[model samples]
Structures are given as structure tokens and as C-alpha cells.
Target: MWIDKLKDVSFDGRMMHNMSLASLSYLNIGGVAKVVCYPLHVEDLSNILNFCFCFNVPVLVLGNASNTLLSDAGWSGVVISLKHFLTKITVENDSIEILGDIRLEKLLAIASKNNIAGFEFLTAIPGVVMASINGNAGAEKCSISDLLMEYKYMDIQGCSHSVSKKDILCSYRKGPLQTFGIIYSACLKGEMSQKDLIQKSVKEKWEYRRNRQPISERSLGCVFKNATDYCAGQLIEHAGLKKKSVGDVAVSDIHANFFVNNGRGKSIDFLNLIEEVRYCVQNKFGVFLELEIKKVGD
Candidate 1:
């Protein structure tokens, strides 16, 4: 359908259909995408968007897929990846403008090198800048949205728009970015600090994360968002689901909130585990858990 039209766009990266998603996601699950297009520049992305708009075709803007769960049945439309468009970091007196495709880890390293203190907490996060912004991704101390000053994006109709931090309602892993466009770049406001101090802080946070999380494994960071006055990990642990397994997907022994994919794990197995954990938590306590990870395409 839309595949024929996609050939018109001058893409610098790979473009393919029926591509396996397991290689893309952190959890290493999911089937395939009908069409996966990685455009090299913003213009390429804009052209594709315009084509999609004219034909009423659906588009899925994917980042690094760290927090995404794709169904085994696969995505049926255009899946645009911004990975190839990453470029340039301009550091001003008090702000940093970064391209959207840059990974958060790389951004954090850049900030640390520049003595930018605010982004230190994000070093341990495992996704791209756009994905972090899309979810307002964060931990206990900070979120990506909190440091953002403004962002440039192409709307679904292929029109460019700049949104300021104030224009968005950002809170607890949720952002005001509508699911109908592609983020190009963003400017972040951060405080400058001494190099040694920033480095020490980053190291400390990294150490804490390493000690507490099974971050090196194949897992989708956190499964559920923390409810008010309670941690989802704590709840899952209390529900007696730690080390629980459904096929090859298992609740991480180190962290109950994380669902790990052992060898040959299926997307359905991970989904089943989510439902089982939710049921157990709801039955044991009166609270229903909310998913932090995004699930798409069946």
C-alpha cells in the first residue's frame, strides 16, 4: 500500500517491510513491522509525513524502543525511526539544543562533559532523546521534561511547530506531546556546575542504579508506573510475584517491576505476565497498576 509511495522519499538509512522487532526493543520480543523506514534527515521525514497525510495512512514514530512492546502480530503501517537524523549539539550560555535522535546516555555524557548538572540523573536511562521526551521519562529525582525549554516537531500534516515547556503539561512519566507527529530537536535549560562535582554526582547515581537494577539484562525498565504514595516495584514484590515466570518472560528477581526476557521469550508471554501481575496486585490490594511501558500493534 504505502510501501510503493515510501520509495519516493530519499532515505539515507535502511527501509524495509516485515522487519523483525525483536532486534529493536530492549525486551527482545515482538514479531515484525509492515514497513520500517529510517529517514536520514528532517526533510526526508517531512516528505514521508506529507505522503502519509495525503493517503490517510497511519504512522508510528519509534525511538530506540526501550519502553515499547510490539505485538507478535506486527505493526501494519509505516514505522518511522528517527535514529538516522541525529545531529549537532549547540551549547549556549545556559541552554543546550540537541537533536531528537540522540540517545539519552549520549546526551547525558555530553552534558557531563560540558559541566551541565541537571541531566546527570538521566545517564542510566536506556532510550533515545525523543522517547524520553515523549514519555516525560524519569526516575525519582528528575525527568527529561523538567529540563526541556522548547522542542521543534513536524505535525501530522507535515507542518513544523515549536512547543515551549510551558505549553506542555508534564508530570509523572506523561507529557503533552500528542501521538501524531515527529520530534526534530529540543532545547534544554540546565544549571552549570563544576566539572568534578558533576562527574562525582553522575558516578554516584550510576553506582546506585547499577546496584539496584538489573539494567544490563534484557528487560523493559519498569512495567508499571508508581501510584500515589506507593512504588510499583514494592507492590509487585509484595504481591509475591518476584521471580514469577510466564514462558520465557519473568519478573526480574532483582527488581519485581522489571519484566525480563530470557532466551526465546515471546511478546505474548510478556503480556500475559503483565496481566497476571496486575491481577495479583489488584486482588491483594485495592489499587490497579498503570503501565509505564507503551504497547502497540497487534
Candidate 2:
């Protein structure tokens, strides 16, 4: 279905059909995408979107897939990945402009190189720039939304638009982003700081994440969003759900909020684990756990 609609578009990036969905996701569990298209440039993306719009082909905009879970039944539409267009970073006095596909880790490194101080807390997040923005990704005291000044994105009609911080609305891990649109690039406000302070803060945060989370393992960063006045990890641990497993997917022993892939894990396993934990936490503490990760495709 998607292929027929995209036949007229000239795609320069990688293209795959019925590709293994697991390889593209952090959870490492999914079936396959009906069509996966990676556009090499903005023009290519525009062309594809135009074609899809004309033919009524469903499109899913994806970044590094770090904060998503794909269904085992796979996706029936077009999955457009922005990985190829991530390039260039421009640092002005008080802001940094970055391409949408850049990884958060790499972006933090760039910030550190430019002596920017606000992005240090994102050093350990494992996803692309757009994913961070789409989910308003963050931890502790800072969110990616806090640094965003303005962003350019293409709507479902293949028309580009710019949005300022005031035009956007976000809550926890959800934002006002449309699934059919693609984020092009964004500018983030950051304070210029001494290299020593930036390095120190980055190192401390990185070290804390390394010690607290199972960073080396295959895992979706966090499973559930913390409810007000309570931590998801703490509540799960207290409910005796730490180290719980469904198939090869297990709750991280180090962080109960993370679900790790031991080996050959499936999306069903992850879903089952989440449901189990949610039920347990609700029954024990009367608290409903909200998912921080986005589940895509079916």
C-alpha cells in the first residue's frame, strides 16, 4: 500500500520492505515494517510526504526509535526515519541549532565542546534529537523542552512551518506533535559556561547514570512516568516487581523502571511485563502508572 503511493517519489536514502522491526527499536522486539523509507535530505522527505498525502498513505515519523515499542504484528504503513538528514550544528552566543536526527548523546558532546551548560543532563539519553523533542525527554530537573527555542517541522501536507516555544504544548512524555509530520531542525537556548564546569557537570551526570541504570544492556530507558509525589521505580520496587521477567525481557535489577532485553525478547514480552507491573502497583498502592515510552505500529 505504501509502496504504491511512494512509487513516484525519488528516495536517495536506504529503503527496505518487510524489514525486521526489532533491529530498529531499542526494545529489540517487533515484526516488520511494510515499508521503511529513509530520506537523504529535506527535499526528498518533502517529495515523499507529498506523494503520501496524494495517495492517502499512512506515514509514521520515527527518530532513533529509542523510546518506542513496535507491535509484533509490525506496521502496515510507511515508517520514515530521519537518521540520514542529521548533520550540521551551529552555535551562536546563547543558542545552538541542530538537525533533527542528531543523537542526544552527540548533541550533548557538541554542547560540551561549545561550552554550553544546559544540555549536560541529556548526556545519557539514547535517542535522536527529534525523539527527545517529540517526547519532551528528560530526567531529574531538566527536560529537552526547557531548552527548545523554536523548531521547523513539515506538516502532513508537506508544507514547512516554524513553531516557537509558546506555540508548543507538552506534558510529561507527550507533546503536541502530529504523527504524520516530520521535525526538520530546532534551536535550543543554552548558557555559555566555562569548559571546566560543563565537563564536571557532564561527567557527574554520566557517572550517576552509569551507576544507577544498566546503560550497557539493551533496554528502553524508562518504562513508566513517575506519578506526582512518587517515583515509578521506587513504587515498582516496593511492590516487589523488581527483577521480574516475561520471556527474555526482564525488569532491570538496577532500575525497576527499565525493562532490559536479556536475549531474543519480543514485544509481547515487554507489553506483558508492563501490564503486570502496572496491575501490581495499582493493586498495592492505588497508583496508576503512565507509560513514558511510546508504542508504535500494530
Candidate 2 residue lDDT tens string, 1-298: 5476556577777778888788788767788888888888877788888877887877877777788888899888778888777477888986899765788888888888888888888978888888788788888877888899988888877888889989887777765585556778899889989989999998898899999999898888988887669999999999998899999999999999999999899889999999999999999999999998888787
Q: What's the CA error at residue 111 for candidate 1, in Å?
A: 0.8
TM-score of each candidate?
Answer: 0.95, 0.95
Tell me how far the alpha carbon of residue 225 in candidate 1 is from the true structure, in angstroms, after superposition: 1.1
Mark the regions of model 1 whose C-alpha exceeds 4 Å error after superposition.
Answer: 10-13
- Say what the RMSD of model 2 is: 1.5
- In TM-score terms, candidate 2 sits at 0.95
